[model samples]
Target: MERTLSSELNTQQVSSKSAMPLRLLANLLQWQRRMASRHQLARLDSRLLADAGISEAQRFSELNKPFWR
Candidate 1:
């Protein structure tokens, strides 16, 4: 029983370690997407901004946010 428990714990630890890279990749992708969206948001003209119901202040707020956020 002890051996079985130890083996299971080891497997779980290995699985979690393997998942870390995938998690970091996912986070990097998300940050990239956030950066792209913020860039597009910054390019919007006043008319488009109004149409989208986004104020200049709101756009500034979003644009100023860190990609990690």
Candidate 2:
């Protein structure tokens, strides 16, 4: 079997390595969205929270989570 530049570049290890930075960025964006939603949750009025079925304790727990989580 012979290897070509294109084939080598498409290998699992190389492709995974190439995607690492993009995946990290995507993960960070998702984390930021989660954190932002949590911040929004902290600002929700009692009526809205009740409508969303989120209790005060639940909202507090989510809002307290670290962005890395």
Highest TM-score scorer:
1
Give the per-residue lDDT digits (tens) of candidate 2, residues 1-69.
999988987796788998999999999999989988888898999999999999999988888888888
Model 1's alpha-carbon lDDT is 0.96
- Per-candidate count of clashing residue pairs (backbone under 3 Å): 0, 0
Task: Evaluate all candidate structures by whole-model CA lDDT and list the values in order.
Answer: 0.96, 0.90
Error of 2 at 43 (Å): 0.7
Clashing pairs in 2: none
lDDT measured at residue 2 in model 2 versus the true structure, 0 to 100: 100
**What TM-score, to 2 decimals, does candidate 2 have?**
0.78
Give the winner by lDDT: 1
TM-score of each: 0.94, 0.78
